[model samples]
Target: MFSLIYGFYKHMVQKDEYCVLILGLDNAGKTTYLEAAKTKLTNNYNSIHPSKITTTVGLNIGKVDVAGIRLNFWDLGGQNELQSLWDKYYEESHAIIYIIDSSDRERMDESKEIFDKMIASENLRGIPLLVLANKQDIPECMGVREVKPIFNKNSHLIGKRDCMVMPVSALTGDGVDEGIRWLVDCIKRNSYLRPPRNQEEM
Candidate 1:
């Protein structure tokens, strides 16, 4: 009888956990975005300045509880050498945020190439995607309208999952709240299909 009650107590105290992946090319502001997100979602988090946040060669993790669900973010490195390691995390991710360096027009093609690979993967089927056009604070940076068409060309590979292209400036922390709220809601709606992990499973 005691064991039964203990199990029930544990279950009530546990929160559903979801894993989110942050992927993009090097200097696409992936780390900056991660930091901004942490500061936004978690109360009183002192975020590192965007200029001081360097490239991630491996991963930077942040856990934040939204409502009752816990989101675990794995911010991976974006260098050419690191791109190959992204797929290894797909099997565990519930959603993906693909950061785009909108200010750097030259690397758009290269970014698309990598993004296509992710969309083509069977492992990522049904996983939600959020494309954040970083550096929107720049005077000449591409906006959501321009960035949309570039990724739209690969729509064939996206399947019928929830995907959105939004504008954000990690440096200035604009649009971070809306973007994260959307992601949280999408994952909740999809939780029945891909159920979030429990404490032990995560």
Candidate 2:
């Protein structure tokens, strides 16, 4: 009876935790997206303005609980100089959220180059990937369909991974929740893809 009670207590205390990395080029709205997600999930109405968000020099971390799962987001800086630091988190991340500035058409090619390099890293193999074409509120921003071709070119790079791209407006809180929901569902469905856990729980 003691053993059974201990097991039940352990089960009750175990939590579903996931680490998600948010990556994109500088000025792609990564920070805004992270803030928006936290606000939406926690119902923090006093959160700072998404438009007033500045470039992230290092990292902005946030936590949200959805459907009993705790998601820890790591929003890394996207400046040219900061790109080198992205791979440091790849090994520990269960999934990735790559944001793009849809209105910055001139940098689309550059973003694709960086994204290709990122997915090519062996550390990211089999990890679920969610790409957000952010800033959809901009009148001249590119839609998901328009940006799909750029990322879909090297299918072999992500042959073992699941990748999806969607349009969102981080500043306006559009599609952020749906994107996170899809990511969480993907993580739950692919149990093998999850990071290692303690053997006692397994």
lDDT: worst 10-residue window of model 1: 193-202
Residue lDDT tens for model 2, 86-106: 999998888999999999999
What lDDT does the true structure give each of the candidates? 0.90, 0.88
Candidates in order: C-alpha RMSD to true structure: 1.8, 2.8
lDDT of 1: 0.90
TM-score of 2: 0.90
lDDT of 2: 0.88
lDDT of 1 by residue, 85-198 (tens): 999999898999999999999999999999999889988998899999999999998999999999978777997999999999988889888898899999998888788989
TM-score of each: 0.94, 0.90
Kindly report which residue stretches of model 1 are placed more than 4 angstroms away from their true locations once superposed: 1-9
